[model samples]
Target: MPMPRRRLILWLATAVISTAALPPLYAQTPPPTVAAAADLKFALEEVAARFERDTGQKLRLVFGSSGNFYSQILQDAPFHLYMSADEGFVFKLADAGKTVDRGRLYAVGRIGVIVPHGSALKADGELKDLAAALKDGRLQKFAIANPEHAPYGARAKEALQHAGLWDAIQPKLVLGENISQTAQFATSGSTQGGVIALSLAKAPSVAKLGEFALIPESWHQPLKQRMVLIKGAPPAARAFYEYIATPAAQEIMVRYGFAMPNEK
Candidate 1:
């Protein structure tokens, strides 16, 4: 071979070797993380597992009270999506320009009163009966999520007030940080009973511990759970947000005891 031609061939071989030594560009892409309400823990886990299986993209979930999650987002927590137990929180984030848009209402929750298994309480449990139980000392303590932070807690309080028992049982209330923890308070026997989300009450773990009474809808405003992509979310995050509203995910939400939101 001519000297110049041989030198060019050598340069081309070196370029090929260097290109082969470089890492794949897509290997560096990160998974999206979502900050969700604690009550959504089980349902979201199931949905996320399916999402990963189908798309090869993982979802990292951080669960807490909606109020707490909102505060974290304000301070720039590293989350790509937010699912709140109340639409009000999502709207607050959107109004403040922290969320991508107005948000999508994914579920409507019902509040309930739960008692530990074998507590000899009848299935037809009522707030009045709970008040009576408390007044007579048959039930010394009751658990509820903090009304200041949890939508379920607020609804529980409203139900009690509607039954004219709020002040009567205020002193006996044990406050949990959020709906999931409040369910724990009752199921773990830390408290004799609790007011919690119906979704939590329906969980296998919770069902084994007790029966729950659905709080009358007239007692409180609808519990509309909403989800939104965070402002500046990447494409993967936006895709996950859309995936959650698909029929498959909606079915899972219903099976987990969430009602569909009323159509506008």
Candidate 2:
């Protein structure tokens, strides 16, 4: 070959080798971290595992009370996604310009009155019975999450008041930091009973430890769980948020006793 032709071939070969040695244009990156409500621990774990399998993106979750998590996010907690048991916190973040997109409702949760397994409590247990139990000294202690910080606790208070039993039971109440911890109080037999999310009560851990009654929906407003993508969230985080609203995820939520927003 002529000199000019050989030089041209050599340049092309060098370029090809350099490109191959460079980092992959679409190399796999580590998955984003998500800050989620404690009540969602079990269900979200399953969802996250499934998401990893389907999308090849790992999920690192940090679970805590919705209120606490909200505070941390405001302090720049380094989470790419946020899932809250109540919509108010998500809206708070959005209003503060902390979120990338409008917050969306993910699930509706039911509140319940829970007692330890084989506690001689019958189904359809009413607030009157609870009050009578407390007054008669049959039940000395009751548990509820802290109303000032937990949405479940707020609902529990509303239910008790609506039933005209809040004032009567106030002295007997022991507060937990969050619904999961409140359920822990009842399930661990530390208290006679407590109010918790139906979804948490239906978990395997709770199922083995206690039974619960669905609270009357008329007592409190709907518990609408919501999610938001952070302002600088990566594509993977947005994709995961979208995945939570898919039919597959909705089915999982329903199986765990969470009501789909569109369901009657």
Candidate 3:
């Protein structure tokens, strides 16, 4: 039987968590929902899977831009925890009384250039190749997450600006909704290449599609990834939040190319 529109709205608003929803990620569950930045897609999934396997506690993880997740939390989206790619979001939520307290830094993120195999562009960390390609007309569309709301995108913009290519590259930009999609566009052969979270580029699936190199960290603001628990977080949510700081979780993050907070 076809469900009524009212019931569907209620179910979707309260239960389902998907990136395609009008306004995405959400509330309650057999286990509480966790809103995480898209940059953490690969690393966090592995950490959460380990948590579930070892502790027998399940969690519903939803990934998207950190800024969007912050807005959702402000609207009382019911996510039991939030892992933001930028620590500022967590601090802002803490000030707003949305989170229990300011979150702990879980990982330090890095952005890099990914050029799909056979592109004219080279995976140059210093962006010298990018500037050369832009000047020589070898570059057309270049993918990046939307800088307005995605932390990794913001860093990518800063790096380009530092390289003095922001204005020149502006004509050839393809903006993705988040880091994962940015990496996808970079490797899909749609665009020549792009700047995306290092963690995403490190994924075996993504790595096979391209060559990647870390953009110099000095080019932009730091990506201090942090995680926090909601005021009324469930036991599983609290436990997972704690577990993310453990050695096991940090190792998973390192595997995905993130630097630990404790590192210099």
Candidate 4:
């Protein structure tokens, strides 16, 4: 026997009412991810902490060579913001439509040479000591970030080449994947000395282990560091991006030995 039309309509209405009573699904927002340069390891951590305290927003930092991060971002990595050691990388991303726009210059980096305590390279005579130690065969190895991909490494190479020391130092060089690792190689006593970002040398971990001398900015091109917000960045990322330019964040970078872009 066929069911009556009124009974069928009543059953359909009950099903619709039960479904409507259920809660609607809401999309959850993911935490912000930042691709940061290795030189920022300490400085960014300090700034991020202050940012969190002020804004109640937490951010995850992934540190590596800026050039490596550039290649990763090109591959569609899920970073919400990028803090590059080289401004060129940020500009390249903007040109590729990967970033929101040409980002702001956040800091200027400087390079320096660090010699660990108890090493043959003493701080009193500085570079002169390095020369003497090398001539006496007391200094056998030196570490530096790989110039092929790390901005600081490139600067370090430039400084050596400018001083007519590259040809001699090249053979004894121990390359690190990045500046932080280079500092480690020097401070850990794995190498006699290293040329690294001044910002890293100012970090307490490295400062206590070694003494560093400024490499004079004239030896190489300027390290104009910049940062950008990735396209479709979350609210937290955007907020943090703006916060980086604030006085508090800039002060942290200054404390870490970074020169403000406009401070001259």
Candidate 5:
């Protein structure tokens, strides 16, 4: 074997070259994680799917109340981006320097009255029928998200107050952890009716179970949805942040009943 020194040297050089050409283990970065508002469950899912198909990028989405996510991000949660149903939370994060910037308003959300089949309550856009029902003792166990943390819940409260029914409905209210859960509560026969995100009410699965009518925009403060990249966000998250503002994604959001930014 010692007689083949030249060939052995050539073989060793080839092995070193191949090893050097191999990519580093760290090169395979995992997909980014995005903390999103619960109202975005259906719409964001579609946009994320489209993003993967178009650009081969993937995102891991976690849906919750925006206010809760805000608190978690302040505690240094691992989310790469945060999408809030309320722009206020995004501004606070930017002020804290927890986000890449002040964030951008992505969409405006709306709340609606949803009633399941055989419910005595009518799916009225105005709270007129709701008022009449409450007056007559026909309303019981109505639902809304917990207003303390959920933007939709807060808006729902405002709308009720606008209709002068907040005090009357409070006693009969069921509070969901988030708006999506509120939608379930609205149609699960647990509650006679509830105010839920219009986006959720528009889903075919949810729509099939109930009738919905949009509460007027003037009834409450606008649900201004905003999104921001977290500090040290990975490239994928940044890409998503940009993609969400694109027309394709906005179209999906619109289909889900979200009013895109800059629209009347």
Candidate 6:
């Protein structure tokens, strides 16, 4: 029964060849797809780049209004992860049984008033100069993201209302589809100024376009941001979800003007 040595050697050679042809375990991991709120456009890119460099993993980032992303995910968009400027959206997804687990708070965001260079709108005590400019007809237009979806826009509206300037500024206001576009409107000279995410104002490109003053946090509700893994996420997505909590990635977010979740 143990006499077929030539045939046994041939079988062993075939098995070795088949094993060599298979891809390595790491190569088989699918890349992650992430849906992120617009406020994260710059900061998240930096984090994703660093993650790629450190872990050899690539992430596909889709940026939009969190409300829009919420609607899309409900419709079964193929995202592996979701990061929202408002934690409420993540919680909503969890309530609907769309997330693998309860999300974690990532950062707290602040709103700012940005005025393009050479505009009469001075950084005069947050809303005072803006109110004055509007009253005097010196400010033709002001921009903010649409509050129906963008968390930053909702905060902006709340801040303006808290300052008692909402009614006066309403007529002159122009609304962007999202916070990133609101920053663009303010920076592109389409509007003299806008209320946008502080993190965007801190970005180098946006910073050079204008000067920004932080709107008091007391004026609006806290923008407690959060991130979650979608049900059936790939390994890369899980890795990224954990990685953003690491000190290195958290530092990058802090550098971009986001307050750590623990910060006052």
Best by TM-score: 5
Give the per-residue lDDT digits (tens) of candidate 1, residues 90-145: 99989888987988988888888888876634334457778668667777778898
lDDT of candidate model 1 versus the reference: 0.84
Q: Candidate 4: what lDDT? A: 0.88
lDDT of 6 at 142: 93
Q: Could you tell me every candidate's TM-score relative to the true structure?
A: 0.88, 0.86, 0.88, 0.87, 0.90, 0.88
Candidates' C-alpha lDDT:
0.84, 0.83, 0.91, 0.88, 0.93, 0.90
Highest lDDT, which number? Answer: 5
Query: Which pairs, if any, clash in model 3?
Result: none
Write one digit per residue (lDDT tens) for candidate 6, span 147-186.
9998999999999999999988889899988899999998
Query: On a 0 to 100 scale, what is the lDDT of residue 21 in model 5?
Result: 97
Q: Model 1 segments beyond 4 Å from truth? A: 1-21, 24-26, 120-125, 262-264
**Candidate 4, 74-125: lDDT as tens digits:** 9999999999999999999999999999998989999988889888886522
lDDT of 3: 0.91
Model 6 spans > 4 angstroms off? 1-30
For model 5, give the RMSD to the true fold: 3.5
Ten contiguous residues minimizing lDDT sum, candidate 1: 118-127
TM-score of 6: 0.88
Candidates 3 and 6 compared: the better one by lDDT is 3
At residue 260, give the lDDT of candidate 5.
84
List RMSD in Å for every model shown. Answer: 4.0, 5.5, 10.6, 4.5, 3.5, 4.9
Task: Write one digit per residue (lDDT tens) for candidate 3, span 49-162.
Answer: 999998989989999999999999999998999999999999999999998888788889999999999998999999999999988999999999999999999999999999
Sorted on lDDT, best first, the list reads 5, 3, 6, 4, 1, 2
Better of 1 and 2 by lDDT: 1
What stretches of model 3 exceed 4 Å from their correct place? 1-29
Model with the higher TM-score, candidate 3 or 6: 6
Candidate 2 — worst ten consecutive residues by lDDT sum? 117-126
